[model samples]
Target: MLPTTRSLRLGFYTLAIILGAVLAAGLAMRHAERQALVEDAARANQQLALYANSLHTLIDRYRALPAVLALDPQLRAALNGTVSTEQQDALNRKLEKINGAARSSTLELLDRTGLAVAASNWRLPSSYVGHNYGFRPYFSQTRTQGTGRFYAVGVTSGIPGYFLSSAVTSDSGEFLGAMVVKLEFPELEREWQGSDTLLVSDARGVIFIANQPGWRYRLLQPLSDSDHADLKATRQYDKQPLTPLEYQSLRRFDDNSELARVVGPDGTADYLWESLPLTAEGWTLHLLRQPQVAFEDTRNAALAAAGLWLALVFLLLFLNQRWRLAKMRQRSREELEQLVQERTRDLRTAQDGLVQSAKLAALGQMSAALAHEINQPLTAQRMQLATLRLLLDHGRVDDAYKALKPVDDMLTRMAALTGHLKTFARKSPSGLRERLDLAAVVDQSLQLLDARLRDEQVSTVLHLTRPAWVRGDAIRLEQVLINLLRNALDAMQDKPCKRLQIRLEADEQLWRLTVTDNGGGIAAEHLPNVFDPFFTTKPVGDGLGLGLAVSFAIVHESGGRLSADNHASGAVFTVTLPIDLEAPVSC
Candidate 1:
């Protein structure tokens, strides 16, 4: 069989469930990934901003120290070659005192010849006393450009720091020398020691400051021959090798944020990289933040969400399936009920047809009996009229009066017979029940078939001794009798002895009418089909084969049993009706 609607619906719902689960999973994964990315970017940006602000504030705080120190009369007089050796020594002590309060690594005054005129670290072992610092970019650039800044390893102290310088001058703007201050970031590196990776790179992409010592002075990019030569001449990093850090830019979000894969001692790891420009120092600050924890949390949340979504989808599908099943069941029940009603109507129509067929069969037989029955009474009345006329002609008025009474009696009998025939032929009411006389129904039926029975030489014997009453439609009961009598007549037509016997008997609970024909018994095989419609042993034109079948149906509808059996000499049909004790008995 083809699949039912319910099955198809289930199949469709199953597909939808699978698709919905897949869709939910995909959405959850995407949402988690997007959320992780956004959070990482925001965090990286915030850290970058903080680092940049700290670096800027540190630089700005010390930026004015070099310019202000350049204006010192002692430092200026010593750098102008106007101060004596004792005065230069005094200026050195003074500069050392100032450097201690300024938190600067070194403070020195150099002459226009790039020779140290005075220094703050003159008393130290690694000092700048009498050192020729003209090879330094800061000193040379400051003499030419009036001010300069650079990151380099100090030639005298052998320590790395950012150099800031300002040229010294008289009121006439003559270049005397330069005052320089060295800013070391050891404290800054200590402050940055934590989980986050912080780096400051110079313009050439050389990492100048880093929290991790291993990353300091490393090249963020590859060093070409030109950059190598420049670094060599400047001695910016001293003897430090500028190795390129293993950093690969995987994806860039914008100018400030990017995803980078960095090869480290542990393994390759991804980091969200954010950068900010240090405009005053011509450098950049970078912050590398690991997002593993955030991503792990997001993954767990996404899985949970996907699980919840799948469960909800299943619940909805289950409820929908239940509702659809209920509707289908209701629709099927209604369809079954309608089909049953149609079948009931068909059965009622067939019952009505059977009753109508029995009536028509009775009418056919009555046609012949009606002529014979009317002719007899009519003939007797005509004879009586002729006799009355004769008596009147003989002047016997008393005798004529007696003849008139006999004629009137004949007319009354004729009228009564015609009335009964008319009643038998009329249409029967549907589902009507009333008190009825069984004997009268049998007499009326026999009266209609009387002429036909005589023509067939069939003798009918009635065993109705008294009136038997039943509750039924009178016309239908009469039709049942007529059909039985006609069948008896047809059965005995070819037999030498044609006899039909009818008996009406009753008990306390039941009344029965039996019609027996004295003809050859029906064939054993054909007996069972005797009451079936269109089943006949007579000639085709002689009978329509509906007589017994219709009679059986009529009796059955009137709450009676109709049965047929073979007797020793012929066929017997019996009808048994339930007795109605409340019915009045008639004589």
Candidate 2:
């Protein structure tokens, strides 16, 4: 036979639910990927800012060296007076000593005619002592403007460095020569070797410094005719080609970030390009980072979360379906049983008679305990009434009145015991909820059991620290406490050292009452069945085994829990009741 229409509909609904979950999960993954990209871009921008600051600090450190050297008396004197062989040698020694201490690439004293008179590298094979720098812009610019800066490849050493120049002047304010300091940043470039690509470009869109050597001296944009002419005239790059880097802006995220396809020396790939402007020096720093790893992690995390959510949804659906099927089977079984009962009405009547007989037998078993409980008060009342009658016969009215008081108290005690038995046998009340003091309820329960506790020689301890207000029926709560106390007392009846402890604690959310007894603890095998209906460890006729079950139901209905555990010395029962936060505080 084919599946039913209901099964087909259920299958379709399950498929739809799965498809919808997959779609939502895919959207979430995409959103996570985009957010990761944005965060990566922000981190790249911060790195660019740090690199820019480091470069600026590196350059400023050499800026003051040239001006300070311009004020040296030996260099000024060598330029102003007639230069003999001895004087030139002395000037070279002075410049070499100063350059060595400053850790600069080179320091030179240039005459007004732009010819190097003394150089820091005079000891090297390729010395600049007699090299003419008349073609260099730093020489002429400093002569006219008092100071100048330039970045270019060295004509003598063929090394790239920045040149800082300051004009030397005589006491009469006559321009004599210029002091030039060459600052090379090989260490700075070495420090930038890492995963990220770092580059700095001048205002003219020409890259001067880069971690990758192939990227250095590349032009970000095509140069104008005039700019090319100026570079040729100054010989700044010294015959090096100013190649244009192949890059296309694929997408722009914001003003500070973009995605670009860059053709590097190795190959072409996409990169996240982040830029920060160096406002102090009119330069810009760029950082290129790969986004593949970050995007992959985001995708994985989203899929994991989606998978977990889907699993929970499927589990819940399966449980609900199983419960529905079970209910259907139960209903069918009940109908069958009802039909059978109707056919065997006379047989059922006989069975009912047998059930009543069994109930009567159970009542007979309980009769002994009940009789014991009621006998003490009844016997006391009888004796007191007899004494009262005797005192009245002797015409002692005052003594008779005292005797009558004792008889009345005993009768009242008996009435209370019977009332408790009636309440325990009846159905639990439905709508008698009120805000009641939990401490007072506990005290009342303890008072009802006080005589039994004293008779059994059980030491009682109370740790009620403060008022615990809870919402529930007072009678029901008291009944629960009374049952627990009676059970604890009964459990310790034969123990050598009998002790019962009750504690009340409350927090903002709930009130907790703990009842502990020293009864050598409950047996591990019987613990799980302790709260089950009609299941107990006591002898058959000793208990009906419904006390804890009834207490558990009452506590659960009142939005609380009743739990039992074995302590080292005995058994512990805890009752947790929800505190009525909105109720007025009471003492």
Candidate 3:
């Protein structure tokens, strides 16, 4: 039944008072939180920025000493021309004196290619003496990107330290060499740890440096169930970098009280962020605090005073109409039930969509691998048929027979390829586990691409750790090996030195195989993105870019992983496979 106007008015007032108190308290807490957060972020950032400036100034001072030596008349004269034994001895003595006076660690004189012509304090290996330093980012960008700098690990001070390098050039704009100065990051770590705050910098938002020394700092939280889900949501939003104030708010905001002022994206909100720029490190620091913490006492007092007023008002309302209040409570309970059902349905639909998307992605990767696998046999068949037709047209009966032999071989390969596809498509039960010979599986996979390897003039050296056993799908393990070899061949195709090495190592419960090539190595920047799906370096139409993605899936399915990195000469892809724990193993 519909309520009367008087009852409706009373219910509206009750709801208004409850909601108004909650909103007022929340606003009061959040306001104070924002102010405190701003102060804390500013103070912490100011100190870090000051230290960074101090470090930069010190580096600049030490770097200027080399320019002083370069301007000295005696130093320039000794470097310009050849001299007799006595003159050379005197020049050497002068250089020694300058080096001793400068007191700079690891002084070196380099030519145009960054090769060290002479050095002080430590003798550098001749192998690297004339090598090109142009590949290093600091040297490469020095002329154009003036005052370029970067961090690199070095072993000059009887211990490893970060080397800061700067370019050295003559007055006429001729590039001479680069000067490297070492700074002890460990010492800096100690200073930071001793301070009340921490400093972190994300290198142009790509590489994140956490100030702690010795411990490998992780910018991302552990993807564990125990971590607060709200925090992860904030982290995902942060990956694309937020405004300076937004970043500070996310870090400094107290999570316990659900009170925060989030700056709206696109600068949409007026009372949103508190922008605090840390000028020293050129970082825009954002600050957010817990609003509840700020106004808790005041809010509590206000509520207590309001409670006395509410008591008198409630007494009058209840005395006038008790039955109407019970009816309103019953209606609220019914509305809550309806809302729960609707939200539950929505959540279920979202989860189903996520599962479907994951399946589609997996299928897309498999399709690409199938394309690569099928193309090999098809190409070989075409070449073989072409050769046989030429022999037949030439009336060379013996040669025709010889040519037809390869054609026959191609058809057999096609049959085998079809067989592999059939096996992969089968709906076999995977829960049943059994011990399988991993090396045998790898050898069988290599046979699939033996013809292609021979055609491309590529050589293989297989060092098998025999009797290796793993608990996994036999077919899937072989597929992983096949994908790796195919990728290795693709990587080495342009190299003058065409060689691939496949080495295997096995323990009682694990198997590791390394597929290496002697081709040009991978560029450092592109190394991390290689495994991402649809990421290919090949020209358009050459690849759909799912080779490694499919390989990774197979390894993971078998309780293993595949990793790739650049070696000294070329790239190396290593696969680690889980094996039977009780298997008898030998190398």
- Of the candidates numbered 1 and 3, which has the greater TM-score value? 1
Clashes of each: 0, 0, 6
Clashing pairs in 2: none
Q: How would you order the candidates by TM-score, starting with the best?
A: 1, 2, 3
- The residue-by-residue lDDT of candidate 3 on 1-587, one tens digit each, is 35688789879998887876566556644554565444444333333334554444444334434433344444344334443456544544554444554444444444456554444533334223333445445555554643344443332223333334545655665655555444445545465453232334333322122243322223312233433353233232233232232322233233212223433323322222223333323433222222212243344434433443444444444443434444544654666577876665555655565555555545545544554565456546545544554344335678667665566665464346535532432323333256887788777777778799888988789899877777777766666788778878887888766999998897556688899988777788888978765568888666645567666766777788889898889889998877666845578
Per-residue lDDT of model 2, residues 1-587, tens digit only: 35688799879988887886687678767776776667667656655655665676577556656766776677788888778899989888988877776677899989988889989999998789888997898898899988877888888898988888999999998989899999998899998887678888877788888897688888888899998888889888887878888899987899879989998876898899998776545678888877643444455545554555555555555555456555655655666677765545545544565565555545544544444455455545545644554345335788677656576665465346534422332223344577888998887788778789888888999999567888887767887898889889888988988999999997567798999999888889988878775567888556656668777877888899999999999999999999877757588
How well does candidate 3 match the true structure in TM-score terms?
Answer: 0.33
For TM-score, candidate 1 versus 2, the one ahead is 1
Note each model's CA RMSD in angstroms.
62.1, 38.0, 26.8
Which runs of model 2 end up more than 4 angstroms from their true locations?
A: 1-11, 299-301, 304-587
lDDT-wise, the better of 1 and 2 is 2
